[model samples]
Target: MTTGAPTPTYPARPRRSRLRTFLPLGVAAWLVLEIWLLTVVADATSGLVVFLLLLGGLVLGSVVVKRAGRRAFQALNEALQRGGTPESGGGNGLMMLGGLLIMLPGLVSDALGLILLIPPVQKTLSRYAERTVDRKLRAASAGSFGDAFQQARIHRPDGKIVPGEVVRDQPGDEPQGPVPPLTR
Candidate 1:
């Protein structure tokens, strides 16, 4: 019989996660809303007024984001200095994102961003972030597997019996050589 050709097997492609799809849609909606607001502002107010408002929003957002960023960095640094991993869940990136959202030409985004920039809210967010990180660390440490004997036996301060093998090697003895060695 003639040799048959091999069948081709294609590799499966990885699908994009829902978050990836939703984030772009959300950003696009925000942009469209901002454009609509800009048009409204242009129609209702003079160019000078729009410019002033934009400037004010930029300045306010910058100040808020900067202060939050500094606090977040300081907290992260302190944690790292104490031999712990820095908590970055609610870090400068989030604050910057909020500030940028505020800079969009819309009242709603600005208000939401302002709320996010508040110190009390940021502090609460940071505490929650820290706790989350702590929980993850604890879970990871707990989940890790070690040598069975490590857990099987633990020495007590008082001479008490624990259920496990204890092997002790003494330092003194030497065995005689060539003593009826091996039989096949």
Candidate 2:
């Protein structure tokens, strides 16, 4: 209890979130499973069959992605013609995601990608995603990303808030030339 010198204290390190801690491990396990499944399929059938399957998947995925892109572009154009902002994603994003998954090496990815391509599945997923986002936005506090645009205060990393507005230069002011480099 008796000390000649005062004790020094250090700041605690920020804790890692559960998702950050476990995601890598989960991905590694998934990769291992995919590779094992591929090997099993190859052994059951033939190497040529496996090669053909992969090639087919790549082609199908590309086609799906292209179709989704075209649809999204068309929707945007239509919205512009109507003189309004584009509405929510018309399952194009989900379709593209499915395509991306199909393009991946694993059978599980292909299956999931295929599932995403389905109209009903896409609708369900999109609705779920929208609801989740809405919930999160509603729950967000003043400092969260959702509330940043609504507030007038400028939030600083060190918790300082300065209220201000930009004062533009006069119309007659010429644009300043680039600053010269300082000589050593």
lDDT leader: 2
Model 2's alpha-carbon lDDT is 0.88
Q: TM-score for candidate 1, please give it.
A: 0.53
Q: Write the per-residue lDDT of candidate 2 for residues 1-111, one digit (tens) a residue.
A: 776766655559799999999999999999999888889999999988888888989999999999999999999999999999999969999999999999998898999
Candidate 1 global lDDT: 0.73
In terms of lDDT, the poorest run of 10 residues in model 1 is 175-184
Q: Give every collision pair in model 2.
A: none
Clashing pairs in 1: none
Q: Which regions of candidate 1 fall more than 4 Å away from where they truly are?
A: 1-5, 69-100, 104-106, 131-184
**Candidate 1, 1-184: lDDT as tens digits:** 8889877565587998999979999989987887787778878987787778778888878886687678787888899899998765655665776787677667668878877766678777878878998999887677435544466675554434365565564777554465583232
Note the Cα lDDT for every prediction shown.
0.73, 0.88
Off by over 4 Å in 2: 1-9, 141-184
